[model samples]
Target chain A: MSTSSTPPAPPPSNRISGTAISKEIRAELAVECSSIKSTVTPGLAVILVGSRPDSLAYVRMKKKACAEVGIDSFGYDYPETVTQQELIDKVNELNADPKVHGILVQLPLPNHIVENLVTSAVHPDKDVDGLHPLNCAKLVTAQTHGGSVKMNWKDLKSIPFHIACTPQGCIELLDRSGVEIEGKRAVVIGRSNLVGMPVSLLLNHRNATITIVHSRTIDAQSVVRTADIVIAAVGRAKMVKSDWLKEGAVVIDVGINSVDAPDTKKGYRLVGDVDFDECEGKCEKITPVPGGVGPMTIAMLLRNTVNSAKRVCGI
Target chain B: MSTSSTPPAPPPSNRISGTAISKEIRAELAVECSSIKSTVTPGLAVILVGSRPDSLAYVRMKKKACAEVGIDSFGYDYPETVTQQELIDKVNELNADPKVHGILVQLPLPNHIVENLVTSAVHPDKDVDGLHPLNCAKLVTAQTHGGSVKMNWKDLKSIPFHIACTPQGCIELLDRSGVEIEGKRAVVIGRSNLVGMPVSLLLNHRNATITIVHSRTIDAQSVVRTADIVIAAVGRAKMVKSDWLKEGAVVIDVGINSVDAPDTKKGYRLVGDVDFDECEGKCEKITPVPGGVGPMTIAMLLRNTVNSAKRVCGI
Candidate 1:
């Protein structure tokens, strides 16, 4: 009677493994890529300005991913001194290239290069990054029209218009994990166009009541605690605490921040906006930083490229 | 208590009079319209597909407003038997005509006619109603870029792109009333493309945190109660009760619903989403139905027409 059986053997961790899911998606994309290659070879043109180490690493990873999925990757590297007009000209050249199904411009361009002008220069059909104004507008229109339309995400081959990679990845993670988005309260902790805003729109399209809390938000913690699904993309390292989340909330961490670490080989460690260690057991399903949204982003990008190829080839 | 003092006079009702503000705006627009007319006549083409009484009444009101602002109004009347192709053909003709600076297709076309196809047929530059996909996309792009750019709504001559009229009207009301939008909690009920979604984006661009609650929202009342600014656009009469609001919240009621009113010869009266009588003293400022939002919408449309004329005429 006195034996207290190890506190009922605490329930298993509910961590959502984006790495495994992304692997599966990449395998599927590989098959789709090969099939599409028969009619038209899928190609992605990645434009990188200035050799920021991090940006270079991201580009390499993307190129590697494209190769893995059997898609063609073309790299266009520019010097730091390149003019904005030069960049726009390159984008226009890529836009006219029928072989280039998807064009991606690496972000954080040099100060002199106006980002929006360069990004907008890409043709909407080939703008796989989905930052083009037309694509964003289409996303907004989808939200209103999607209210009555029942979309089967499982059967989804390609959205006619491209969506931003990270946000699309976040949704893919949620959907593949068997999470029900309809009627859920989803709190997005940033409002960046690339991630936060688009992701919130995607969630709303799926029928999730959304609350967008930003830097100016008052009592952000309380607002977050009310969410059934929490998407943290504010770029703050470990800013979210266990107490800030409701018990069993689904957490998707999109932030990747580098923090100093004396013991690490790289002299720093990468952490997400969420405090993973503290939030582990509290969450019903949570994505780990490096292995979570990072891999999925690349996967979605590959998918977009393949989709664009199919559309261009009339598959 | 000394002298049995009467409870301090209830603070004066802070009604944000959209009617008065709209009149003021219309006057300003009239001046602008005349100035633009010096170079080229500003014309708005109102397309009426069917003979629905309400649609006819709205069309007439718009035409009257255009006249009041000294802009030319052209009517295109078609019976209910009009085909979608004919409407598109007419819109294309108006799009090509320099005289038609703005083209508006009155909504609620016959069931057979696709609404989006007809509305999208108008060129973006002449889409005074601002329902064009390109215009909606521009509005979204503005939100992302507007973060660092300080826009003076007071001195705003014309937005480079057209925004949905009702949403722009809501913002105009708030700015004119001097209700602080930045750093406020805004709750938008409904997520309609015409009013709710765009207005929420407008508020977010102004630095307010936004929460969108739709019909599927759980505990919608509590979510709304947290708002400092409540925009009720759900189109349900008297749905937002006084108790569902934060004390001293600013309310913009966008719903115009008809309710039974036996005393009136019309047999019905127009009401907004917010319960006016119960919410009057509770709100710090609130817009009234019939006189609020409604007039401002018409005013915004005329302003858009004049703006389009100025752009087209290169004035």
Candidate 2:
């Protein structure tokens, strides 16, 4: 057989793209933003304590996301030497600002500053990150009481408050991708507060049979192989191998890890916990790295900000 | 002739008695309570908004428990028609009173009043029931961050805050009975905020491979049969038969359902979710209803009250 006779394989394109879905969500939020009856615009205040490259980039991206949705974005950048009290004062100021409906303090704060003290200073109503203790408590309460687990942005009246952005983003991506979450066997790999734990609760709220697989979980591979939906957020690069997944399972990769790539200009490339190439032809749906959960996070942030503003306006 | 030869089965006395275990815990708490350096006594203030017989009985038991430990107990009884503000005001009054170190609001408040509002009004440190939003958030945070999962009342510094009484009691009962929880295959039935959800989280925190089986779970019996430790909190009478349990599995029955008993004074007798009669000689350990988790809740409440008083007095 001649080498040229073999047809070139088609591009690997059967997957959920967070960038495209996030754009759709942003467009929807923009419409809601313009329709607000209140004279005050939906505003987000971003506080960046240190000038770390990744942190600055994230803040800039969040501000741009705010602008795209017709929101008024405010930025505050503090030096690495900023004291804890100074940061908390800024948060209190933002809390009192009527125009600023949401306040977000970027993570990985400097060593001298206590992150919890600063995060808790933001008023729950103005907390867009949804990392506030009160917000976390509300989620626990809602989940325990069998409250609204469905993500219906149109029906904000039922939800207690802003949900954690990353988990909310994961759900938005899954729902918008047309995945049926209810009554499905869903497995979440990892149990971090940031992604794994809250996402499992959200899935359970939507009536899915949830099993959380963490580091100490025995027979993790076998447990994951039974899931109709698999969420990987363990933060290890390509940890969830192809063989670990069930056939035709809907996969949502929430990990963003950097691996060595000598050919790239930065000498590093991003990859999800799942080996994307390995999952190419097996899963019914999967999310790609860099453009998957990353984009959806900011979109949810904007949506939460708009929701906060709407609540303030009583609209 | 066969029944006579069997010698009547030696009376199933191997099971853990919550009443006996709770008595031990109360004894330990009493010793700690009497050694307090503060001049004021540890006090618990319970607010009962209605005349529900169950609620009244629960409150009366709590006061009696407090008195047994040389602690002060206060009660606030209000009509069901009391407004939300009135209840909240009473909570605030108790919160400010130095004499009252813990405040508990009876559950199933009048339908007219929002329960969350009244629950949140109780100060977090003084929330003896551990149902306040702050305390619930702390539990979620601890579980997510790998905090202390073991119940070590003697070493209070390790615990971030008080755990939910029933869940804490479950762990205490197991620990006191010498059932090792670490690295075990644990199955939790039900997903309520009170018992099931928190118990699963607690078990997970202690390095157990946790599987939460709820109403939406499929093949629940098969799933449960794999557990080395089974916690049944589904509130269904005799739902977990012997067939559903693995041989030698340790069982913690949190359910307190009243099934028909025509010969009894109340026309009913309490039973756990587990069919205890069927598991007489099979399981390694089990908890019986009416003398199991029921007594431990009040013991935990007393412990929490003393801890709160210690915190208030900076002991």
Candidate 3:
């Protein structure tokens, strides 16, 4: 008769918050940065074009993160009308600068300026975003060429170059949270070069059975349901439902979608590809929309800058 | 009941042969070569550092294949004592030669010479093997940048670069044979940069659900059995058996393993990764050893040389 008196235990929280994990990484990076030579701080050069509000915000956040880690941040703000050659010239100059260890050009450059041309201009050694063809090629070939059969975030130190930040962040979160990826089924939605494609490759490198479901993928839900790990990057808001997930599936929501929220003071709110409310209890672990992968991106960029600097110093 | 003797219909032969397909492609190339401006023919430079019988035989075959397609062949034979710098100098020399439209450094170079350094020295524009880091990066990002979402061999022209010959050859054989790859389940065994890794990425570009089973993959057979198509590139001999395939799976065996055959004149016979005897009648389609994948590789290399020459001449 007294059994009803026992209060229902609060639903155990399995939220894998990227904010906390990123803080841990940033703290570790700060210690590493300090332990390195005090004479020269790791330098990160960023070139931002066409003052898009979001891109500016992202660039600002990255610079601030660099400062927090005791790294030198150099900024080059250019007008939207900057010629491709001029941008390439700036990149080449940065490439030759002894002070700069890593270089990143804020993405979504002016339509006239080809993204690939601008991104590849960054020296492969200093390409913190890992977009340069040589770096990309190295990432592709590294697994088969003297690298580990399975990739883990801890193993990133052994890799000679930068990895795409967002994907690296996604993996870092999963890895830090103690989720086992080896021998697991991983489904990556979307196949964009920046996120889906590279993450899939990284997962494959980690010995996961990977399935990439894109725009043309048939039965996307059924395919996703088979995964132990699900990475949604289709830029769709709350598209993944409870049914799409298997019991105890770990979810890494990479898509950041803005949706109308009448009740909010701002009139809008950011949501992820997975419906967080439905998935919170169902999933073994899930990342939140605003506080999850969003913060880790900048943290990874800082780590890449430090690593790039370490390489130059032959540490 | 009267018993009438009837011959069992030999299991419908669904074997996809590479020799016949290569001959067809070479014939087409020969015709194209004759129709093009004949003043300056396409030329291929091959640098062989050692006289390993297999390497020499491979170089000779490549040279002979080039001749059949009206391409000029330039050979550079060096002793095993050659230094890495000497090999690199030779590559650089050929790279600057206007007559050399494509350059291939025969693989398994002298122990002292690094394969990647030599392979990368072949100017990317003329890297016929597509082993250069830039070319490998281009292959990785090609789809995300300008190429189609789902890649097929026919779309190779739009990529504006040469793909790894062996992997491209596998896809070409499958495509030309009228096998549909769209939305199919594909399992690629092995993750070698030259074959398994690139082919898996190619199949993913073609909208197939790709599962790559490498040395670290657990329960490899069960993982492979779910595929509608399986590509076996692990160098092991006869590792893929009938049980490893789905009932109607299309198999592309890229592995070429030499096994001792006491009765054979050479005392050894070439076999693919699949146990063809058990698979010949069990699967819907399968490529055979010796005549499968082997010839197609040389044919694709010839195609690449011609394409490179065309690019230089802006044909």
- Write down the C-alpha DockQ for each prediction: 0.49, 0.43, 0.48
Categorize the docking of model 3.
Answer: acceptable
What are the clashing pairs of model 1? none
As for TM-score, the candidate ahead, 1 or 3, is 3
Give the total clashing residue pairs for model 3: 2
- Deviation of model 3 at A25, angstroms: 1.1
Candidate 2 interface RMSD, angstroms, 1 decimal: 4.5
lDDT of 1 by residue, B92-210 (tens): 99999988989999998888887888888899999989898778876665633322234443433446778789999999999999998888999999998899889988888778999
Cα error, residue A239 of model 3, in Å, equals 2.2
Q: Model 1, stretches more than 4 Å misplaced? A: A1-11, A35-37, A81-93, A96-98, A143-158, B1-11, B35-37, B143-158, B312-315
**Model 3 error, position B271 (Å):** 1.7
TM-scores of the models, in the order given? 0.90, 0.92, 0.94
User: Model 3 Cα RMSD, Å?
Assistant: 2.9
Docking class of 1: acceptable
The parts of candidate 3 lying over 4 Å away from their true place are A1-11, A143-153, B1-12, B143-153
Model 3 / residue A176 / CA error / Å: 0.7
Return the interface RMSD of model 1: 4.2
What is the DockQ (computed on Cα atoms) for candidate 3? 0.48
Best by DockQ: 1
Instruction: Output the lDDT of residue B108, model 2.
Output: 90
